[model samples]
Target: MQLSFETDVEAFRAEFAAFLDEHLPRGAESLERPRSTAHIPEWARRWQRLLFDEGWLLPGNPPEFGGRDASLLQQYVHLEELARRRIYHSFNPQGLGIIAASLLSFGTEEQKHRWAVPVLRAEKTAALGMSEPGAGSDLASLRTRAVLEGDRFRVNGQKVWTSGAHDADFILTFVRTDPDAPKHKGISVLIIPTDTPGVTRRPFGSLIGPADLDFNEVFFENAEVPAENLVGELNQGWTVANGSLGHERTLLWLGFAERLEDLTQDFRPDGVLGRDRYATLVMDLQALRLMGSAALARAARGEQDVAALSVLKLFGSEAVQSATEAALETAGPDALAHPARTAPFNPMTLEDFYAGWFERYARSFSGTIAGGASEIQRTIIAERVLGLPRG
Candidate 1:
């Protein structure tokens, strides 16, 4: 099936494209991806601020929240353009995308103005504090403890895979307030300032490479946070946590589809194996696009198809992984070389396409596991969509 936007949406897309062209020049100078939140250059900061000021940061949000309250189709077109051009409006995804969204959904008016506003304006950065050593997929089993005092909560625990924590202004942390309660209960979210006493952030690398300082291990020992910093009601953190992930998972399929489409444009048939794989990858990309379009249409009509969303999320991420892996294999022994010594990662140019395939392949694994793992999606689809019994 063909998916095309209406004339008004097409006009909106053109207007946004012009704005991007005027601001983002494709000349001698280009901005490389920042190493970490702390390493963002002044130019990048200015760029993000400009996007916010111009109401292009988040088209779906209201004007005060760095958006113009754009319609659903407009937002879809906006995302499509950004992804197609590989432009990131915000360098801090966990902050602007997940944390700020959560605050908007569940934060008090004071919290929204105090924390979320600055983040939307690019004046502050945040890191999500979830997923400890023992609790990655099964997040409810987290062991971090926070004991409330008269006016503050003294926290003591470790949080692993806290992305961009070292340089972030604060961490939107999830901690257990009552150990006696069930695993899912007695949990709460706290807006913990990174500079608070007894707070330590150790930046680390991922499978992407040692130079990629995107993840951190944060340790909070006797860290005292104000009681007012609590997000949502006490022992209702599961709700906030679900809302955070829901925000993240929403519309992610568009990005997945965009990246795969970009890669497909540069893929070349090596031999019979390459031809077969390329054909399969193309078909999968088309299927993902159709599914994403259908999901978007359903959303515009105010419908919530959780099972369809589960399938789209699971299929889109895995399709990207499969395509990138195939491209790397098609490049043969060349992909075996050390990634650092190879060409920089730029899918826009064919010269660096195969050279960057290994890096892309390495990073694809994270997408499958990020918002929620593939296993989690499969279980949801089975139990809810297929009406299968949980084993």
Candidate 2:
């Protein structure tokens, strides 16, 4: 299949590049590595605001909801350009991208009008409340309970690995409404404002890099939200959650390709490695990119086999690990010893951030585990895509 963009997309790319050139933060190189989940720097916020104003931030949303009604391919181009510029929109990624999309798809019209605009405009950030201490990949087994009260649902549970919970205005959460129902059938999605009476957020330091990227654990005790906050049909949240995961996997795969390219270029022999090793790394990097692109194209075309995404996740995670390992080899003993240096078009302080990179390596292993483990992906491919019998 031809992966090349048509002329209109080429023009979109040019326009996006110009926007990045004009608005990328001045003196961003000298800025300290980001350290908190606070709003992005004013310069970066201005850029996001520009996109919001220009109706580009949520290009997939319809014009009535402040988007251009752009094609999925066009949306892909926008993301590629943004990632190429290494522009991290720290404001409300979860809100604008994942949660907003979920809400738009499954939320009531009132919920959509109430939540989507603020989310897309970065007026509010959102956290995902899915994983619990014991439940993650086996999401249907989650134990968070939302008991129905007269006019509200009283929620009580702890959600772990919730990114930006401490800073977010709300959480688009998954909770079990009927414990006796089959594993996947009793769950429900809810919108819980962070400032509710029984809600508490505690910050945790990063397992990966700076504290800014810290994921959190949130506790909700008798947190009462209006029954109207329920998203989609009650007792059917598993479907919505799965849909969100599918969207997330697609975005992650695309972002990973961009990051892999950035890392490969930064670690080139003249830049950071020896010639021979760099050549090998380049070839591996190209393969990873092609595999990811192919998977993304399939997804853009509306393929529902989660295994395709899982394959990209598995390959992308491994590719990142391999690239980092190669970089460590290229750095030799000095890898841990060199002062941290910031790369122009990558997450800041990547070189001397050995601790961070190592943390990422550990986390990449979890990428397969988090959304669905690699083994699970293989199972999905076997049963769903390949039509193999389940054991």
Candidate 3:
């Protein structure tokens, strides 16, 4: 079957492909994924800067913001092509995808110039400050507080699971500014420079593998932040938080789809049972792609379907988990052997591919939790789409 679009959209896809051929690093598709989102090597930084300078960083935004005001369909095509090539536009996902997008949506001109521009240009990095120890999926239950003083706000609280915080220039933090108000209403967002006094960061490794220090716990003990750093109106942080999460969950399915596709080709399992499992996986992946396409079409038509996104998030993440597990089972003990750790990592080698199976399987678990856990997504789907009463 042939799927087609406007002449310009196809042209845009061709242009992006040619650009990748000319500028994308050779063997980038097989290069070992970075251990941490904040670990932007010199080459990766240069790549990000090149995308920004060439207006491919955020094609939906204006040119000054490293975009050309491309149409929704064009943006969709752009993302698809990038996903097909497994190319990353930036090392800091939250910084480029969530924080900067939020600032563009809600920040003042001065704030945009100060924070948003630097993040988009890859001149500075940012981390999202949400998901406290007590408030992972339930953001409204956060205990962090930021009180308004004469000219600055005194922030005294802690945020855990703050990705890339240790390397971030600033943190777009959510704090409770009005304790007397409702849980969601009392929240407010603050842009706190990581170097500010009383601010501390502690990096920690995750289950993905050793040397993967990707998440951090950030503390703000009487940290003084200027009042002007507020992104939107006071005590309106829930709105900003939702906006950030929306940006985050929007295109997450693309990566999962790409990974699952790669898995189907890389793992050749024997036996009828294993073959059947892989066949099921391939069908699931096709379904996910169709769902994503439908969601993109709805978005292009100016429709916002929150429930559809929740469905995609739920299905795509779990599908990846299953596919990775299948790949490990197919490779058996060979997949468990650790490949020799080497510099300038390339995964295309047979040894590297087998070694990565276990790590990929372990890392797939994070997808089920990040950007709202699978349980949270199921709740959203049941309550919103299925119209089922809360249990």
Candidate 4:
């Protein structure tokens, strides 16, 4: 697929760029720490509200839901430009991007009317409750249970590694509504209010060391939510979950592109060692970008399967790992030792910074493990994508 932007897309990009130029955070340079996850602050919420007022927050949603009824290309343009400018950090992505999108796909009319507008407006934040303490990538093994009783479902289980649970007003949770049935078949999705009587959220510090990007362990003790809270049909949550994964991977290419640009800025073409290393890194980065962009385009066109997303995830994660390694190598021993003067692009200090890079290294490996393991991705590619015989 051609990667070039069309005339209308170019206009969309220009408009988004102008918005970012006018509204990006002031005094943001003084902030010493880097946020791991995209957690929008109050100022950022005001910025998002501005976008909502202008019908730009949920660019992909229908116009009735406070969106522009934007085409896929238009949405891609918005995301690409935002990521290019590092403006994604200023939006409540979980609400406006992921959950809201999923809701639009599977939610009932009442569900959409109740949640979509607030979500797009940034009035309510949502957290994903898919991963549990015992179940991460192997979501089929999830033990979170929900039992039907009268007009409500009683939910009782714990979800770990839940980002923004403490700050979120609601959770889009996956639970087993039928323990006796097959693992994947018994699952169901629910939108539970975080302020429910039996709910408790505890913040768990990330290995990444970002204070606001706290992961959480959420406890649901016989939490009762209306039966109408269910998203899509019962025992079909896996389908919805898979759909969510596809949507996420579709947009991740923009992030990978942004990282690639950041990786390139550190290169010094005239320097002897710099020229050689930079050349190799840039080539690999371009290849990864090509693969990721292809996967995204295929997904957007609905030509790719859910398993194909795992391939993009694998390639994207590895590219990020390789790029970080190259950046560190370029810095040499001084990279180990923080430079006396910090570059605007490379703002991290070397001392008190071991934890961040270490976390990146660990999480690069974990990213493979998070969405799905590299092994799993390879299996899917081999058997599903490549038509290899199962062993």
Tens-place lDDT per residue, model 2, 62-124, is 866656887777878888877776566545566666788898888888998788667766666
Tens-digit per-residue lDDT, 100-201, candidate 3: 999999899999999999899888999999989999989999999999999999999999999988888999999999999989898999999999999999
Flag regions of model 1 displaced more than 4 Å: 25-33, 37-39, 270-273, 337-355
lDDT of each residue in 1-391, candidate 4, tens digit only: 5878689878987887887788665565424443433355565566567777776776766667666877777888887776565554334556666788789899998888798667776667788899998988788889999998989999999999887788788999999998998887899999999999999998867655455455889999989999999999999999999887666666664565566565566455654227777786677678767876676576567685666566677776777677666655555554443332353432222223322333335455555565567788889888888889999
Distance (Å) between predicted and true CA of 150, model 3? 1.2
Report residue 160 deviation for candidate 4 (angstroms).
0.9
Give TM-scores for every candidate, taking all chains together and pairing residue i with residue i: 0.93, 0.87, 0.93, 0.85
Q: Model 2: number of clashes?
A: 0
Clash-forming residue pairs, model 4: none
Worst 10 residues of 4 by lDDT: 346-355
lDDT for residue 316 in candidate 4, whole number 0-100? 69
lDDT digits (tens) for residues 1-391 of candidate 1: 4468889899989999999989973433443646675344456667778888888989889988888999988998998888777777777878888999999999999999999988888788899999999999899999889999999999999999988899899999999998999999999999999999999999988776787787999999999999999999999999999999999887988878877787667675564236788788779889998888898999988998888889988999999898878767767877666553455554223234224667778878888999999999999999989999989
Worst 10 residues of 1 by lDDT: 346-355
Q: Residue-pair clashes per candidate, as listed?
A: 0, 0, 0, 0
Weakest 10 consecutive residues of candidate 3 by summed lDDT: 346-355
- lDDT-best of 1 and 2: 1
